[model samples]
Target: MHQLRTRPARRLVQLYAGLVLYGLSMALLVRSGLGVMPWDVLHQGLARQLGWSLGTVTIVVGALVLLAWVPLRERPGLGTVSNVVVIGLALDAALAVLPEPSALPIRVALVPLAIGLNAVATAAYIGVHLGPGPRDGLMTGLVRRSGRSVRLVRTSIEVAVVALGWLLGGTLGVATVLYALAIGPLVHALLPRLSVEVPAARAVQPVS
Candidate 1:
């Protein structure tokens, strides 16, 4: 009990770190100017509307999405709620620190590094076991409730978000495609090595 209570704060730290790395990767990806991922597109769109940094927009979006979680009656794991807050803070910090690329040559050079960082971000993502992001969570929940195939549900959600972001002047390019293709595999690959299970008992259990 005592331990579980502490887990959320601890997880917040870990999530903050993860979001920092994720945000850094995203900034690099954006620098490449190749395209942005679905979430990034949305962040960029919101940033434009609000006249804020993309990172700030990220936090705002994440917070808003978290509001939906309360209604779903999904068990709000320590990681899940922490992720809702920390990702945005970390993203804001990372974006402020990482400057935009100044030239096409530099931008092109950032692609591979961006890809690798993105993979690292994926591991960080699942490490917390907070279920999916807000958008993903909504789609997944709908699929489960409706007994629809995950493929169709996921595709529809992705298409809708991408389309909406695009209409809002979000960047869409090779990087977006790259993120769609690569992030999943990277997460699958790294999950085994990086994951940590939550302690079964909050307090240290007595030895039998």
Candidate 2:
């Protein structure tokens, strides 16, 4: 952790930039009128049903999900708490500024671009190694407790969320499926290259 603090400027920039870009990417997808990632599907549904903005729903859901960490014995780091607050704020801000596109071709184009930006943003923040976001931590926690493979746990959770979100009237389409399939590979490829390793002596500190 000390090593993390030692290069505060770089880590902080990476963390905040990644988070801001993540929010912007989400806004892009929403504005494109295409499907979003599973958790965003839930957020969009809840926002629609509750007459709230997507970002408001995201923050609320994130906080609620964080509560599950107690039972899982997961501890939040600076990035974790920042993820809860910053992403939502940035999402709302980006959504406010970005206009929705009407053309089908433009909307379709936006999906892949948004997904790619999302993957890059995800890698940036995660590579900092401060902590996983609340929803991700939940999946990882479940994996640890159940001794299941990450693929199984992640797939199960995503399936449940997508089903529930669809039931609640969230948009589900090819974009959602694309995001699910592409994100894993994108993150996998990016993480190794982007990750900032901690010092060997300070490696004993918990990542989260």
Candidate 3:
């Protein structure tokens, strides 16, 4: 039997690499003791509720979201598919490797760090020409079926999650705003150059 070879665009490869790097940066962000992404805030809440490691919660959530992608029949392409596992795995490992930060100064520093990491992650993620993240996928599917704009759907979801996570004792701070405002442009700027291939179809846009 002969093995078939598949060649992906260079840009896709760059995005894949970016995803892994972003995962690493996220681990540091969490460890920095500043704050976390809203989704991660939920993960922390779920971790406490379920009595599991944050990493375990990440894996569970990511897996559940990835499963939803099946129905969309959206082509994840190579980079997006890799993102599902790589981000989760790298996040878990990075958490273990990175020490939790001490003092308010370190935490403050982490805000920028997390922001930068997210930008890189977004850049890589978008580059894949694959489907969006599980959460993003949900929003896109909803919009396509219901004729709602993805922006509204995504904002609603992010607000709800952040609120819930905050109520559940997740830290909400400057980092949250940074994640919201900075990540988009950075990713937009970086994505085009990272990979040579563009998706034939548009994927759900990333929310900063």
Predicted structure with the largest lDDT when compared to the true one: 2
TM agreement with the true structure for every prediction: 0.82, 0.94, 0.81
- Predicted candidate 3 versus true structure: per-residue lDDT over 1-208, tens digit per residue: 0100223445456556777787787776677666677687777777777888777777778777767767865434444456667787788888877877677788788778778777766766665445566666666766777687777877787888888877777666667667777766777787666434433444333433
Q: Candidate 3: lDDT over CA atoms?
A: 0.68
lDDT of each: 0.67, 0.86, 0.68
RMSD from true fold, candidate 3 = 3.8
- The CA root-mean-square deviation of candidate 1, after full C-alpha superposition on the true structure, stands at 5.1
Per-model clash counts, in order, read 0, 0, 4
In model 3, which regions exceed 4 Å deviation?
A: 1-15, 70-75, 198-208
For candidate 1, lDDT tens digit of each residue in 1-208? 2434545655445555766677778887777788877778877776877798787787777777667656665444444555566666766766667788778888877877787886776576556554455655666566667798877887777777788878887888888887888777777787666555666554221101
Residue 106 shift from truth in candidate 2, angstroms: 0.7
The number of residue pairs in model 2 that clash at the backbone is 0
Which residues of candidate 1, in runs, are more than 4 Å off?
Answer: 1-14, 130-132, 199-208
Clash pairs detected, candidate 2: none
